[model samples]
Target: MAVYTELKPEAFARVSEAYGLGPVQEVVTIPEGSINTNHRIRTPEGRLFLRHTTVRSAEDLRFEAALLTHLTESHFPSPTLLLTKQGRPFLELEGGRVSLFKWLAGEELRRPQLTPDHLERLGLELGKMHRITQSFGGSRDNPYSAGQVRSWLAGLRRHKDDEVATVAEELEEHLERAEGQRGQGLEPRGVIHADLFMDNVKWLADRVGAFFDFEMACKDSYGLDVAITLNAWCFDNGAYLPELCRTFIRGYQDARPLAAVERENLFGHALFGAVRYSASRIRDFHLSPLPPEQLTRKDFRTYLARARALDALGPAGFLALLGL
Candidate 1:
């Protein structure tokens, strides 16, 4: 869960006043993603979402605000920025960046069920997202790239705990193997959601309520995007349901079919996906001076389970199960 650095009402009120919004009433903190402090605002106008970003991304709010506006205009159900009395998209609040959005209608679904219909729609919407992709929404490369992974691991070797350090070292080795395989090109590039876990997908009835958290959105591999979704949506403990992977992938492939190479690379991409989450969790659990909630709890458990499975069956055996 996101750990909010709570601001005094008076401090937050300064922002409210900037946009001439609200006879401010309540500020209720919502627990979800990292990097932002979000509060549900109850005011004379109506309920709204107030997001205070503690971490900055390559793109500023203007682009995301525009992106949301773009998605909304496309008839996608995303939360758009709300205009204040003065018609500003955001109110620069308390020394930090702050913004408001209309509160989306949503009911969080824990253990989200993956029915055939849901997968089909998800694939369609994801493809729809790609149709509206932008090239320069952000000015920096994504931190999840091969180079960044190496840089982080190099830094981690300094102060990580044994478990974290071991994972970091393993990350180093896998990354080297990945580099050796570099004659193999990455998948074709385009703007991808880059973060499409179950949490980012909201459910309102059978319809996808909205896709929130556009912060990590980036220009990256289409295959990587698929891997991100599968890593998040497919496995439960530490195994792959090729059927589930097939379902989501076929759903995507129906939009734009995967190349034979990408299909063959699926196993490696799957492992890449796992290591991404694993590294992020280890980094956050050790780094992040402002402790933010990550998937570390689930990640290490997944790691241990995968390790046990590997030990029981051996590497060749595990790959055999993956159909690699």
Candidate 2:
């Protein structure tokens, strides 16, 4: 239902021919993502995921293609971009760019279905990805940095809705406090999968089969990545699950031991993560013009709750909560 760009039959045929995929047997619209238009296309060869996005530029796509190639060479479990007949990573069609990837084999585990083992495996995989990306030569700044989030919040604070405006003011305070307490920024830096929500991971039984959706991948603090991931995975029903948090961090540390600096600065990073997502949800989801069928709206208040909880815990209390 998140198909922002609708492709015609001729478009599909052209894409299949260009990619050397045989006649298309089936085309089903994928309704999961919020940014790009995705479809599951079945050809005589096999099933592939077709992603079309109007918002991304050619340079961005190239960066992603290069990153995916590096990941493939490193033997990381991720989607490999299929090249066109001309050796390009994607094709231009229907006023947007389209990229094809062989469908990965696995199902995304829902929140309730996730266990400590699942979080541990996910953490290990994330840690492995961060380690692998250290050798990657590509560089791209995080598009959703603190400054960008602050700009979004500034606009939200002037909204016509009093509740939204008030919430924006509250988030501004969190952002300011987090920036002040984040320290001298001496933590390790590297490329990270900025958005590692549960849906980004696919599982084959208890083990992770793949980590996809590298569109938001960019260079940033590794500790920030850990904080964002913890926010995504460890929180449920307005609270952070202590057991899941402990297991996730333990699994990550097993792969690449966090420096003492990382441990000390995690609280600020976590608070920033909560503030960033809360602002984004309000701007991208709550205020989106797209109808319900075209976009999935996530509650901004959920992340606001996370910010409040983090603030209540304070820095020392947070480290204690994570048993760091």
Best-matching candidate per lDDT? 2
Return the TM-score for each candidate structure: 0.82, 0.98
Could you tell me which 10 consecutive residues in candidate 1 have the lowest summed lDDT?
291-300
**Residue 117 displacement in candidate 2 (angstroms):** 1.2
Candidate 2's displacement at residue 174, Å, is: 0.8
Tell me, by TM-score, which candidate is best: 2
lDDT of 1 at 91: 60
In TM-score terms, candidate 1 sits at: 0.82
Instruction: Give the distance in Å from residue 257's predicted Cα in candidate 1 to where it truly belongs.
Output: 2.5
RMSD of 1: 4.0
Positional deviation of 183 in candidate 2, in angstroms?
4.3
On residues 1-324, what C-alpha lDDT tens digit does candidate 1 reach at each position?
565566788876776777676678878877765557778888886788888876663246666766777777778777778766777666666556777887778764554467756766676677667665643353334668766767777777666467667767776666564444322555666667778877788878876788877777666666667767766666666665556655666667667766756655554555555555656666654455654352122344464343333334433453454344
**Candidate 2 C-alpha lDDT tens digits along 1-324:** 676888999999999999999899999998777689999999987999999999998889999999999999999999979999999998999899999999999999888898998888888888999999999999999999999999999999999999999999999999998997686558888889999998888899899999999999999999999999999999999889998998999899889889988888899999999999999888878888889988877999999999999999999988888878
